[model samples]
Target: MDVLTTQTLSGVQTSIEIAGTVAFALSGVMEAARKKLDAVGVCAVASVAAFGGGTLRDVLLDRRPLFWIEQSWYLWSVLGLCIAAMVLMRAKHFKPTEKSMQWPDALGLGLFAASGTQIALGLQMPALIAVLMGVITATFGGVLRDIVCNEIPTAFHDHHPYAVCAFAGGWVVVVLHYLGFYPNAVVAIGAATVTLLRLAALQFEWRLPTWKIED
Candidate 1:
């Protein structure tokens, strides 16, 4: 790849990461608000939700310095976002609903899925591992968020396609890259595919088969 192409890919990935962070942070804010948490609680929850999955991925990949630490600006951006969101919610008297959180969560799922898979691929990981990294990056943060909020992780219990969507989308990234699609295009399409599939599942009330135990 040319230097220009590499730089462009980096830019696209960074943009996706930032957007995913914001989406996850907003979802955290909504969840914390639903639990009626105070300012410190809200910021802590949002930070964890925004960074947990990516941090875990970096650990698993043995990437030193971590993504957020290497890109220290992300920390300040998340902090600013949390403060602004809190101010707006209070000033507008915005009542958060569980439903409101899902939209941003879906968006974050897609964005992180693509970025994570691409990053793993860049490291020459196996395709399967890359896809799993994508799934982890997309879903683990929400798992942490829900656990911190004292609820079952929606991805596990909602009876809807959550991680499944990320799984499929991760394959999309793998296939596109293998087919020689440009990095930016691959990322965008993969992310869009996951986000649309998730939104569609929600809109259509799609269900996954649930386990039934005999009483």
Candidate 2:
């Protein structure tokens, strides 16, 4: 891709990044509240869930200033979002369940996967590596969030095709880009594909067969 194309893709990636941040932050807030954590714990978990994956990806790619460091407003935004979510969840009649996180988590997974894939592609990374980065960007945040909350990481133990959703969607982005789709269109299609696939997995309880150790 030319400089113009790369810049265009970067713009799309920024939007996807922001969207994924909000989505993942919401999931973190819900989980924190469900665990009866205080505001401080909520903010901590939410920030990690919002930025962990991207932060790791940036480190791997040796991207300078880090994403949140470059965009300090992102931190403030996530803080405000967590506060608002806490207020909403504190409602007596409003109970946030683990199930409630599925939709937003799926959305985050898709967007981050697309953005990560596009970022790697722009850097001229190999397709498989790009896809791996995408999956990491999409699911690693939730992994950290669960661990911080003293819970089993749902992405690991749920057997619900969480990272698989991101992997499949990453390929969609790669295919679309190679097929000459517009930059925005590629991200949109990839994100949507991942989100829809994740939702379907939840709806159908899709699972990867686990190795059974003989008792």
Candidate with maximal TM-score: 1
Taking the tens digit of each residue's C-alpha lDDT, what string does model 2 give over 1-215? 52454466666466656776888998888788779889999999999999999888889988778879986999999999887777776665555566866666677788889878988887899999899999988888889999999999988886678899899999999999889898778888999999999899889888888888798
All models, RMSD in angstroms: 2.6, 2.8
Identify the runs in model 2 with alpha carbons over 4 angstroms from their true place.
1-19, 91-93, 97-100
Top lDDT: which candidate number? 1
Global lDDT of each model?
A: 0.86, 0.84
The runs of at least 3 residues in candidate 1 whose Cα sits more than 4 Å from the true structure, single-residue gaps closed, are 1-6, 10-16, 96-103
lDDT tens digits by residue: candidate 1, 1-215: 32343467666556666777888988888889889999998988998889989889999999878878977988899889889989988899875566876776777899889878988888899999999999999989888999999999977987899899999999999999999998888888999999999999999998997789999
